[model samples]
Target: MKIATYNVNGVNGRLPVLLRWLDESAPDVVCLQELKAPQDKFPEEAIRNAGYNAIWHGQKSWNGVAILARGTDTEIKEVRRELPGDETDEHSRYLEAVVNGVLIGCLYLPNGNPAPGPKFDYKLSWFERLITHAAKLYTLDIPVVLTGDYNVMPTEQDVYKPERWLDDALFRPETRAAFQKLVAQGWTDALRKLYPDETIYTFWDYFRNAYGRNAGLRIDHFLLNPKLVGRLTTAGVDRHVRGWEKTSDHAPVWIQLKEK
Candidate 1:
């Protein structure tokens, strides 16, 4: 089965481009982030007409996530409205489902810029909860895939201008350490493991015409559980999608796996 993760930026604004990509790519499963639309505003009928069954957790104009599975209604195992210990109900960052018996999670991690502040603290706290949840998932002994715009460049090589991001939240030592802890818990960073030496990327900044310059970052990813590692056959960025008119800053990252 082929699974793809895309940060659509905004569902309404990018509907045309998204529909076109869906038709062309034909991925069996898709996890979308940054819908930027309210729950009532989601175009459920349109997505269903396109042969996808979707379950979305939406909020107004900022953060949202959804899972779309071709020809079948997704079995949403959980809708994490609140990260543990987070009383503010701040962001709609995570949603998880079971598709074809594989536990999948889609997340839109906070872009906690201006570090050494409340936002950065929230990012770290959120990561801590993710670690706790992931540890429990590991105990379940089921195939799992976590995919999304992680908002963190796991390594210097994953970004085009590494030095530029050295001081940014995405590349900070603490952030990387948090991400590394998750990987150490037996989740495989699929793209990195598959093409270790390749400088492939999935997101580009709109300013500076980053896409035109091929300046991008591989912040979007699919982290698979150990059980699914050997089944990973193809992993890549659909960079062409970034060139579409009115496209999202991030491109789709996809993986093809051997049948379960």
Candidate 2:
């Protein structure tokens, strides 16, 4: 089975580009973030016409997530729309489902920009909650994948210029530690496992021709549980997708697993 994740930026505005990628890649399952559309505004019919069934949680004009299972034959059994442990938090950033016999958790983790502020604090607190919840999922002992734009560059190698990002929320020491601790809970970062030394990036800022200069960061990820890691045949970022006209700043990051 091929599982992929992408931060679509805006599902409606980029529907054509997204549909094009779906037709070309044909991943068995996909985790999508940043729909930037309301629940009623989601282009469900368009996505359906492309031969995929989807479960989505939409918020107005910002933060949204979804999981898509390719083809009509697969039943997208939704597990939840919100991450546990945050009753007051209402961002539509997480969506979990069972697709093609695998448990997939799709998320758009907080970007936490403008460090040393309330947003940054919220980001850290959110990370802790995710860690706690992820621990519970790890104990399930099933084939599971947590895939999305985590928005954190977990290491120096994950960014194009480590020094420039030191003070940024996504590259702060604490942020990286939280991400590393999550991985320590038996979830393998699949892409890094496959290309340990390569400088792989899934996102590029639109400013200053960053994509053109290859200035990017590996913020998007596929974190697989031990059960799924054993089946990880290959993993990669569809970097060329970023170069497409009207594409999301994020390209698709994916992994192919052997069927159980």
Candidate 3:
């Protein structure tokens, strides 16, 4: 089965582009982030017509997420709509579901810009909460694939120019450390494992002709559990999609697994 994740940026505005990709890529399962639309606005009709079943958590004008299974009969066991540990938190950044016996944790981790500020603090606090919850998932013993736009560049190799982004939130040492700790809990980063020495990237900014210059970052990820790791046969980023007209700043990252 081929599983993928895409940060669509804005689902409504980019529905056509998304539909085009869905038809072309034909992934078995997909996790989407940054819908930036309200609950009533998720383009369900278009997706269903394209032969996928979807469950989404939507928020107005900002964060939103969803999971899509490529066939009508695919079983989708709803897991959780929001990440726990914060009662007042209402961003639609996390969503989980069980598809074809695999637990899919789709997350858009906090960006946390402007270092030493409230947003940065919130990002760290959120990371700790994710750690606690992710630990519990490790005990489930079932196959789990945590996939999405993580918003952090795990290493200097993940970005185009290490020095240029040294102090930025995404490449900052503290942010990367949090991601490392998550991996330390036993999740396998599929793309990194598959392309260790390569400068793989999943996102390219529009400014400074980033995409044309091949300036990008690998923030989107697919972290698999030990069980799923055994089935990881292929991993890649659809970088060309980023160059499409009116495309998201991010690209789709995917993995193909051996049958369960």
TM-score per candidate: 0.96, 0.98, 0.98
Tell me the tens digit of each residue's lDDT in model 1 across 87-124.
77667788888888788888888888889688888888
What local lDDT score does residue 220 receive in model 2, on the 0 to 100 scale? 94
| Model 2 Cα lDDT, one tens digit per residue, 150-258 | 9899899999988989899999988999999999997899988899999999999999999999999999988888888889999888999999999999999889999
State the TM-score for model 2: 0.98
- Candidate 1 ranges beyond 4 A from true positions: 72-82, 85-87
Which residue pairs overlap in candidate 3's backbone?
none
- Per-structure clash totals for the candidates: 0, 0, 0
Output the lDDT of residue 231, model 2.
95
Q: How accurate is candidate 2 locally (lDDT)?
A: 0.91
lDDT of each: 0.87, 0.91, 0.91
